[model samples]
Target: MPDENTDSLRPPPPTGWRRRIARAPLLLFRAGLGPLLGRRLLLLHHTGRVSGQDRRVVLEVVAYEPDSPAWTVASGFGAGADWYRNLGADPKTVLQFGNRHHAVTARFLSAEDGAAIMEEYGARRPRTARRLCAFMGLPSDGSASALRRAGRAIPFVRLESDPPRRLESDPPRPFV
Candidate 1:
């Protein structure tokens, strides 16, 4: 793994209008514009760990299980990200991919798993992997060791939805 003293992979989170601009896709997803991104991105709905308020963030999907309602995402901002922390506090959340929304349980992947996933993702999307690494301030060489280092520095989460078990007292939301 790279030394901890190394600069963060990506720039610090944006502020003011920049933050709002970054979040525009969240609004678009809620407004039903999700399909435009297809399986590349997912809208994660989670609760604020401190304020106890609902929050959502759009994350790039690292891998999507075709036969299952499971998706993997990476925190390009590393483990200290608010969304990542919130998910740690409460693993149960919602993930919206395109028009399909599913309630999922979050699981933090092990470093080895993250490394493997990153390698596969880099292999499948070499350009995206290089760009992502560059944005994160990591070397964009796309080498196995370089990818493993990037994976170790960033945090990866897998979201898996449970089999439906609707409650009689609760209403069900339509899922496209």
Candidate 2:
């Protein structure tokens, strides 16, 4: 049996049609609808950490730095999410944002950096920030401290592009 803390942290996985519903966006992206979503969202082409099978997931874009070709994304389901874990195991991945696609490496940011990013994101998109925080089981009180705390709790990954892809035979670990 799982402990109370584990149960609390583990959000129920979507099932049946709901699972398909979640993947509909990925299908749209595959069908060349990426331009429609623009920079607000992106398609993460990743490899499964355990199975080593290819996987795709659509995630919201919290921040995009064009010059560095870096994108910051939050895991609304927290760090325990399968995709997040996959990236941790192997940061080599592909990112498709709008019409641009790049070979990217995932870098986990420090809590302090996450806090600042979250604050700036909230200022730009208040409602979305609140909703995301609530969904992630973080406090959504709309205060700076609360936002910072939530940012610290939730995992933020920076996808930096133009990196050389590491061979599969390489050990499972972050490039950075």
The C-alpha stretches of model 1 lying farther than 4 A from their native spots are 1-10, 166-176
- Report the C-alpha lDDT of model 2 over 1-176, residue by residue, as the tens digit: 11245226635667999989977888879999889887888999889987989998999999999998899998776677788889989998898898678999999988788889998888898888898777656667888888887777767899998756689899989789
State candidate 1's TM-score: 0.86
Where does candidate 1 have its weakest 10-residue lDDT segment?
1-10
lDDT of 1 at 157: 93
lDDT tens digits, residues 116-155, model 1? Answer: 8988888999899989889888885989889887777667
lDDT of each: 0.85, 0.83
